[model samples]
Target: MRLAHGLDINHPVHKAMVELGKRLEEKSNGQLIVKLYPSGQLGAERECLELLQIGSLDITKVSAAVLENFVSDYKVLSIPYLFRDRQHSYDFYDSTIGKDLLHKGGDYRLMGLCYYDAGSRSFYTKTKAIGSPDDLEGLKIRVQKSHMAVAMVNQLGGAPTPISWGELYTALQQGVVDGAENNLPSFFTSKHYEVCKYYSFDEHTAVPDILLIGTERWSRLNERERQWLQEAADESAIIQRELWRKAEEEALKTIKKAGVKVNYPDKHPFSEKTRAIMNMFKGDSIAQKLIRNIKSMN
Candidate 1:
């Protein structure tokens, strides 16, 4: 099996993939193997998904925000303020509704294996701090190539610019974008703090990363192979969460030392600004039901 992703090799997700390969090898008694291609050697998130669909790649990981483009059900995960807290989001992923959403992409030849903790996303800017949605006025905020992300940024009163992750660093340096939003670890690892000095903990969204397998490759696996692979992936998710927690702590300390101005803005105003994003999906019954079900979770 070949697993490819766009994250750096030091990323928690990549470390978890290493764990997956080790566990799968142990479970299969050396009969099955997983080859990893990190740092977008094959392609970006969308390109990796396309490769998976055609059986050119066996597995890949992507943000739920990116997955929203291939599977409409995944749009729920990108909604701002959807999950109350980290544990709340974890519970939803382990719930039946979450499992159902995983398979919702089968018709598109994509199958979700599991969800990895991506932490929450917050805003970081180069010029001024984003204390509130009002501060975002006229600022160009970088967003992923997902409609939900675009809408969320628009709702927050910023101009949304979709750019590939690889091109973002240059884009930030050249002032093509005024700012971007992401988790602490990503901001630190990507070294965006060098250019974007202000980091705000508005934490508007807690989007998880998903491990995906193509249906074409999945169909070829025998029952035993499937069980072994699934077990490996399930265990990897647990390992990945712990790694992510540690990375977040280290990233916070490191970025602070690097002279990044970090602040904890009141989340209510930010949440309130994006509240209407839910209404954007009112016409889609699947999305509406998902919203109701997720909110009902304890």
Candidate 2:
């Protein structure tokens, strides 16, 4: 059996997937294999999801933020200051609630497999270091294609500009936006550091990259094949998490050598600024209950 997986090869997680294919082939005695479409050869993350819906793609990796539009329950992960830290985020995924969130996309024809570590996102600016929430005033900040992200920026007093990932470097270089938020590894890989020099480690959101199979394609696999694929994905996640940690450390080191100014501003002010945004969830009983549950976790 041959499976096609889509992801940007430049990403470390892609390396783990390649290792997964190798392990899967060996475990199945060369009966199963995976082919990867790197560099968005298939298309952007959203386009890839559409392909999955139409039964034109087999498996793809996407951020939870991108998957939120397809799975409403995923929006809960985007709430600022939701997870206390990195370990907390990892622990949540290992919980039943996390497993529940993965399966929540079944209605959208998505069968969740496992989560790959994507690291926490933070803000980096071109002209100045953000030392306080007040410093974000009037600055044009680029956000991902998620409403929650835009709302967070707005609550912090910055103008939220939604720019696609591929266009962000140019957007910052040409003065289209003053800054953007993303993981440290992305800042180095996308070469956004070349344009944006100051990085403030506010560490707002921790969104995991999801690996999934389309239910359309999943239905065709035999029981043995399904078991093998699931085992391979679970093992690959362990590999991906370790690589992500090393890559983050390397990325921070590389960018700092390239003349970037890094800072650890008082995050309390930023947290206070986004409290109103979190309160919106309290307005609805369903969302309020979910929020309490997330906060209750270890």
Candidate 3:
């Protein structure tokens, strides 16, 4: 069977994908083989999703935040303060809400295999320390091309500039964009912190990395093969979460050593500012249901 994998080479998510591939090969005893195309060799998340739709690629990893652009239920992950902490995040994923989300992609031809850890997102800037919403005023901040992300940034008073991750370093360096928000490993791995000197620990959204397979391709797999792949994905997720936690700590240490002034701002202020933005979604029936469900979880 010909299987194709795609992801950004340096992304921790890809590391998890590699682990998944390894497990699949081991479990199948050489009957199953997967060829990985990391570093956007196949394309970025959106492009990869498109490829999956046409059955051109077998599997890929995508940010839950990006997946929200296509799957509305996914926006639940974008909600700030939704999880009490890491444990809460994991519990929610293991709950009914998680099960529903995994199947939510079926309509779009993307089958969610499992979820991987993507550390909490925080602010990193070129010159200014983002202590509160006030500090974000007037700054041109780069965010993923997600409406929710853009709304979150706008609520903080900064001009939200949607930019792709690949071009962010140049955007920051050339003043095409001023700063960006992401997790520590991403900030370090993407080398965005090199241009953005201030690393703020606001810990905004804690979206997970979702492992997905093209539904078209998955349908062709025999029942036993499908079961084996599902089990392998679950094992990979467990391993990746552990690695992600370690990577987060190491990333923080590495960035600080590189002279980045890391600050834990009064997150209350940041949270408060975004409340208005969140309220707008209060009327969204689907979003409201998800918000209620997550808050009810723990």
Top candidate by lDDT: 1
Residue pairs clashing in model 1 are none
What RMSD does model 3 have? 1.6
lDDT of 2 by residue, 1-298 (tens): 3234334466688888887898888788888888887766777788888888778988888888888889877778888888898888888777787787788888899978888888888999999999988888999999988878889999999999988787788999999999999998878888899999999999878888888888888898899999999899888988988889998999989999999999998888888888887765665776677678888986
The C-alpha stretches of model 3 lying farther than 4 A from their native spots are 1-10
**Residue 103 error, candidate 2, Å:** 0.6
lDDT of each: 0.93, 0.84, 0.83
lDDT of 3 at 130: 90
Clashing pairs in 2: none
- Sort the predicted structures by TM-score, highest score first: 1, 3, 2
Report the lDDT tens digits of candidate 1 across residue range 199-231. 999999999999999999999999999999999
Candidate 3, 127-227: lDDT as tens digits: 88998889889999998778888889888899999887777889999998878998998888888778988999999889888888999999999998998
Rank by lDDT (best first)? 1, 2, 3
RMSD of every candidate to native, in Å, equals 0.8, 1.8, 1.6
